[model samples]
Target: MRKNEYTKNYDITIVGGGLAGKLMLAVLINCGVFDQDKLCWINTDNENFKDVRVSFINYKNFIKLKKRIQLDVYSKDYSVIEKIELHNTNEKYPLKLKDLNNHGIIIRNDILKQNIKFSEKKIDIYRSKVISTKCDEFNRYLFLKDGTKIKSALVISADGSLSPLRELCKIKYLNNNLNHTIITGYLECKNFNNSTAKQIFLKDNFIGLLPLNDEKNLINFVWSIDNKILDTNKINFHEKIIQMLNKFFLKNNLIFDSPKSKDDKFKRVQTYPINVKFVNIPFKERIILIGDAAHTIHPLAGQGFNLSIEDCFDMVKCLKNAKIIGKDFGTLSLLKTYNNIRKTRKNFITLATTLIFYVFSKKNNQLNNIINYGIEKIEKTSLKEIFKFLAKGY
Candidate 1:
């Protein structure tokens, strides 16, 4: 790889081959909106994050992505969640949230990451890291670490939260430290069925329990712990978690069962820090940021993957519209259209997640108040149906 070898392929170069990049590439290749020769993928692989053991994508999004993109093996790597239950430390019992005419899906992150590699696509692949970028009116030059320079009409920066291309583009972004970290893993239990997904907002942390299988009896647990608590006790945290969870259930008069056998235990444990980042505009010039490069919200709401999916899906739609009209998809006006379409939704989600985290983190009368209000509204008004409609994208 000599620096003199500057010639490279490029019509649209996607930088970052993680889920979002791979996903968009899959759609673009399958949909034939652009010629296969016009598309190239840079950094065709990424670190396999073991911390994200399982991820939840709502049923609506799942079906839409699968149908629209003809996703690679999407149906094979997931388990269904027939129902959802929500609980707060202040509440006596869990409140069941009505499904939006369909259920949700829990995907094994490893399986999906392993299977959706876009191996069949014939586009040019660059495993080199993007070292520098130069933008002009018609083309953007991407300098790679391996001495290959690509000139792309459009560049997609899906390289993740700390995106090198984003930095190179001089895109200003805001970062909000959540002051929390999540410990995610699997816990095997014999008594529980995999029909329901549950979330509990505790004082110092929030816990999400997603059943992995109906017959195998395993639950994927995502525990968001306060930094202070996590820093104070670095030993035997999972053991204490079980005890604390059982006590919460008992005190709330909720039926609970603890795993009694060695076969039924916590395993595959991992922890990671949490933060939220956002850019006001997801695009600058002809380079666009998708997935974590554009934004990363609180994971408590399970909106991370969904938002990324929307980013990819909407991007394709924008390009498709451009293709239909015989317009340049890499133009600034087109990028603005894409940014405008995605901005408000990202803002709303970011605000909502931050607000929810604030309310739950305080654990004051606010928790009880929300629970009571929710119960009353569900019983007395049509708020329940309204929420269902919202969930279903009405």
Candidate 2:
């Protein structure tokens, strides 16, 4: 069958309608670049409108979101975080986010999606998968699974880490698989408040509890142990999680009321390898990549969404400038400018997070001493300012 053709082509076609794609649409439309008729968005995931994963928005990024999209309505279901607490299982020292002057916000993915849905002025969203994409000298072709093809001046790939468009474009990436798994779930605690986020670093693992509305909280447990410990056939995952939680609470002398009923209604966990990688070139010819399609970092600092948003910001800025100069938006020169501006910041974040993981993952006495001393110095210094700057997407 001849692929369905678009006689009236769009100026730009974006793949993947996740947070990154949606945000880009908002930025471009709000900037008055293209109305609904000129922008096309292709998304394959149709089961749910948003992802369940949560993201923490720092002050700086929050401002950008407000300016780029309608945020007042989205803030209704989100939680504002005033402090973050970090503890070492074997040590007495703990760090708190109150040391930092500014606070962050914890938002569910659904809220973000809803906000975008409300803010989008005139953008076409296609609920179909992109099977293949090719670029020639003049126009880029995107072939959808449903026998439709779109020819546009530029194509943006925000599909994510294992992007089909990036693969089709033959882009190379550097991958670092940490061989670790993070298990996350929601817990109902009687005494857990919504004002603080907590992280407990243990000998072989770490636990992060982020408070949501009411008495509910989200728990992210990251274990660096061998994957064999998770027995799929016989072991009860919830019981194991509860046991670990109790052990940590007991060890730290923290108090919390037991569940009203133990029916396992709030028990769910997913285990996946932590991988980080970056594309050598984020753009080529009439094709460009953003968000996880361009790079993915460890989730330790919860900066993945922030980085993706920043990517959209930079790309939109570059495109706006290109338009002013009457230059092609997808040219290598424009993309190189965007890449050069973002690569240094991305490298710095990747290295910093990796260093933190390495230092905390070790159990040697000398390293522990060094970490302890470092923590003491950080507690006394203005490191939170530096951290806030990075977290706020400086």
Candidate 3:
């Protein structure tokens, strides 16, 4: 990987080969929308299992991507969630939501990456860091840390939230530090059927118990708590978590048995302060941002990756249209269609998830009553509609 050894030019260059970038590349290659040889992808990490362990993918979105890439929907690696149960710390009864036609799929993050088919013969993948980027009216140049310079008509940033390209583009955005730290890991439990997704809204924290695979014995949990609490006690966090799970399930009269301390498989406990970040426009100049680089929401809703896929899907359509019409894919007008189509929907989701987090974080009697009343009023129609919206994004 010598820098001055060679120079390459591509029709499109995608930065950050995480799930979003890889999926986008897979779709583009499979769709035949772009010349496979002309597309370039860059990744710092070679698709290793990062902090993200699992994701809850709605059925419709899964199907959509599967059709585009011809992935089998009934893969053994994915676990189906027939129902979702939501409980408040003070409420005796939990709110259950389900859709008959569609269900959520819990998938290991690394497995999804492994399934993506990108032949090295078709795609030019550079496993080097981007050292610098220079753009002009016609083309954008990407300087890799290895000194290989790449020229492309369009540069896409699928990088994470702390995207250097997002900052380099001089795009102004609102970044909020939620002051909440999230602890995510897996647990092995007994007598728990993997048919349902469970969420508990505690006073100071929010917990999600999503099943992994078909066996249903393993639960992937995400615990979002106040930073102050995490700061106070760094030791025995998982031990305390096991106690809480046992207590909560027992108190709630759940059918599942308590988590076993000795048999539990602990991968790694990770913590990071939550942030609600959004860019007014996801594209600037010849660069477009997708995935976390564009917008990041709270994990409680499980829409972060879904939203990224939606954005990438729409961007694909835009590029196809531009190709059909003999227009530059990097044209602002062409990119604007994607931004306009996604911004409002993304805004609504961001706002909705943030509001839900706020409402559930504290015990507000009036807000709770209003939520309950609204849920009761729209329970039948809205749940189905919401699930479809989340699943299909239509």
- Highest TM-score against the true fold, candidate: 3
lDDT of 1 by residue, 264-334 (tens): 23454778788889799878888999998899877776777778888887888898899899887689989
Q: Write the per-residue lDDT of candidate 3 for residues 1-394, one digit (tens) a residue.
A: 4566445668888999788888888878878778888899897784444534788887777878788887664467888878887776545466667776646688878777777775668778888888678788977888887778888889988988888888877877889887798888877676566778878887677888888764547678888997777778865656767777777788645443334445334456677678999788878889999999999889996888988878878889989988898888788897788898898889988887888788777657776776666555555555546634553444
Model 2, residue 179: distance off in Å is 0.4
Residue 21 local lDDT, model 2: 81
TM value for model 1: 0.89
Q: List the residue pairs that clash in candidate 3.
A: 3-147
Model 2 lDDT per residue over 130-199, tens place: 8887778777988777878788888888998788888888888888876556766555555555767767
Off by over 4 Å in 3: 1-6, 47-52, 214-216, 252-265, 364-392
Against the true structure, whose lDDT is highest? 3
Q: List CA RMSD, all candidates.
A: 3.2, 3.0, 2.7
State TM-scores per candidate. 0.89, 0.89, 0.91
What global local distance difference test value does model 2 have? 0.70
Q: What is the lDDT of residue 166 in candidate 1?
A: 85
Model 3 scores worst on lDDT over the 10 consecutive residues at 256-265
Per-residue error (Å), model 2, residue 61:
0.7
